[model samples]
Target: MTPDAILALYEWVIGACFRCGDANLFVTPIDAVVTPRGERYPLAACGGCVLDMEEERRRFAERKGEKYHPGRLGRPPA
Candidate 1:
């Protein structure tokens, strides 16, 4: 997916997760607004007790870290 598409999906996911009380399922702290190419999203965790699924979240976290983390993007880490 293009960055814009991914960002849009991420926002939708965040909204759905929040509405479903699954906010913890996300790894990055995402805003409804589109993040710049290098902005970092907050790290999120799973809302359920399933530990095995954390790997997926970790993957997202890694991607977010690489793309949005300080030094990777022009902005400093929050």
Candidate 2:
């Protein structure tokens, strides 16, 4: 590939987070979002974003009278 194309690919990967678009944040592959028009897009999210999403899930579970078990999404030691 050309130098410009390579650089563009690098930049795209660096900003691959579907939610925050923060290159510095570590990411995990999450589920995809399906639009009403039947388009599906994959997602990856940072730790903070995952925590926020978990919190929302917890709230919804409580509202529905269900138990919420948190997952192990933290980064392990190198």
Candidate 3:
């Protein structure tokens, strides 16, 4: 199976966001991130959390004087 499909399956098993612990039928499956201790963990986010994350990134970009190009950050509408 493809990586995305695998991630989707993993999300299906968990059924909630690692960060916010919000459960949903569909969540954005994030790629695994490595921590300072060398542990890897995959994450998922509900729609609301995803939008909030994007907004935070945009604000950070503005503060850094970098252009925040909003493109394809979230799931496409059904």
Candidate 4:
């Protein structure tokens, strides 16, 4: 992907921290997928945000009276 697109996604993830109400958190890159096309990207998450996400998910699930599952993260195969 282009640098601009990658940066926008990075900024998006950062902004999501606020949406999750875990704005104090940030991601730490641990690994990244290499698309079959050969583009690489980072896979990371902030502990605080993760916790917040989990809590939100829990609330949503309870509100709906069932567990919620967020699908895997990554781009489609090339």
Candidate 5:
């Protein structure tokens, strides 16, 4: 994947962690993901809290502006 794609993935993961409300979560920030890709991927999950998609969306909407709706990103009416 391109650098941008990787960084996007990391951002999504961090957002997921934040939404989970797991204070112990530790993830490589977006800035650090700029490094050259090595033999392994640079993604990790919160050991304490289980990641939930619905919860993430709810939390994201609360913090981000109302324009942050994910459904709008889906395919539009044909």
Candidate 6:
């Protein structure tokens, strides 16, 4: 799903962030996912949510302390 991030969608800049469910002032980075059947649904994720996700990911990585790294494309490096 790729969201077409826009500051204003039809002159509206307030919505719920998919991650935190807060009043979003910046209608940016909205995730727009398209279903296989050609249906589109906007997600709830603001910039703050993206940061939060990144932080959570970093913490998770720290916990695992992985040494092996996968290929850039997730496949084994040739």
Error of 6 at 18 (Å): 1.3
Q: Which regions of candidate 4 deviate over 4 angstroms?
A: 1-40, 67-78
Residue-wise C-alpha lDDT for candidate 2, range 1-78, written one tens digit per residue = 333332232212223566677775556666677999999887777655666766786798799998865553332322
Weakest lDDT window of 10 consecutive positions for candidate 6? 1-10
Per-residue alpha-carbon lDDT of candidate 1 for residues 15-71, written as tens digits (9 for 90 to 100): 223223454244333234336876654433223312323334446679778532211
TM-score of each: 0.21, 0.56, 0.57, 0.36, 0.22, 0.43
Top-lDDT candidate index? 3
Candidate numbers, best lDDT first, in rank order: 3, 2, 6, 4, 5, 1
Question: lDDT of each model, Cα atoms only?
Answer: 0.35, 0.58, 0.59, 0.47, 0.37, 0.48
- In model 5, where do residues sit more than 4 Å from their true spots? 1-37, 42-51, 71-78
On residues 1-78, what C-alpha lDDT tens digit does candidate 6 reach at each position? Answer: 122232122223567776677874653444577899999877655555554554565566678894422111112334
| Root-mean-square deviation (CA) per prediction | 13.1, 12.9, 9.2, 12.9, 12.2, 9.8
| lDDT per residue (tens digit) for residues 1-78 in model 4 | 333333334323342232334443465343476899999865555544444554565578789898654322233322
Q: What C-alpha lDDT does candidate 1 achieve relative to the native structure?
A: 0.35
Q: Which scores higher on lDDT, 3 or 6?
A: 3
Off by over 4 Å in 1: 1-21, 24-36, 47-50, 54-78
The TM-score of candidate 5 is 0.22
- By TM-score, the best candidate is 3
Candidate number with the higher lDDT (2 or 3): 3
Where is model 6 more than 4 Å wrong at Cα?
1-15, 66-78
